[model samples]
Target: MSEIGATPDPGEIKDKIKAGSDRANALKAYVDTVSIKHVHRQDIEMIDLVVKTYELLTEIMKLVESKVDEIGNAKK
Candidate 1:
């Protein structure tokens, strides 16, 4: 609360998003150039499968998050 009208301090939220984006970019870059020379073929295959599963999970999370946002906005 404030005496009159005042803007909120949104810098922390913005910084968090920027940090997340930076981390995502770094992970993408590393995944792009990742190799598995020391690991066996089956182990490498399992790693690839896990990566694909994670990608699918991320996609589904985006859809659910958007639906939640829609519901929240509808209430307003």
Candidate 2:
């Protein structure tokens, strides 16, 4: 357990992000199974937005991981 108001460890955050990315990939796979023409316009739009959001999150996580590596190296 962690103390209230304390920041989470970077490694923990990365683990969580990885789990989330896996979930997002699963969702994308499900989305892919359905035909876009059969789905409602709004639903298709929402799916597209979610996919884009996940892509951005993946990019951000890569940058964060790089920064974490840099920080760790600096400390060495």
Which is the leading candidate under TM-score?
2
Off by over 4 Å in 1: 1-35
Model 2 residue 7 CA deviation (Å) reads 8.1
Question: Candidate 2's C-alpha lDDT?
Answer: 0.78
Per-residue CA lDDT of model 2 for 8-66, tens digit only, reads 46677668778877887898788778886788989988988978987898788789877
- Candidate 2 TM-score, C-alpha based: 0.72
Off by over 4 Å in 2: 1-10
- Model 2 is weakest, by summed lDDT over 10 consecutive residues, at 1-10
Candidate 2, backbone clash total: 0
For each of the candidates, the C-alpha root-mean-square deviation to the true structure, in angstroms, is 7.1, 2.4
User: What does candidate 1's lDDT look like per residue over 1-76, in tens digits?
Assistant: 3235654234443444456555655655665576666778886777677567657655655565566556656666
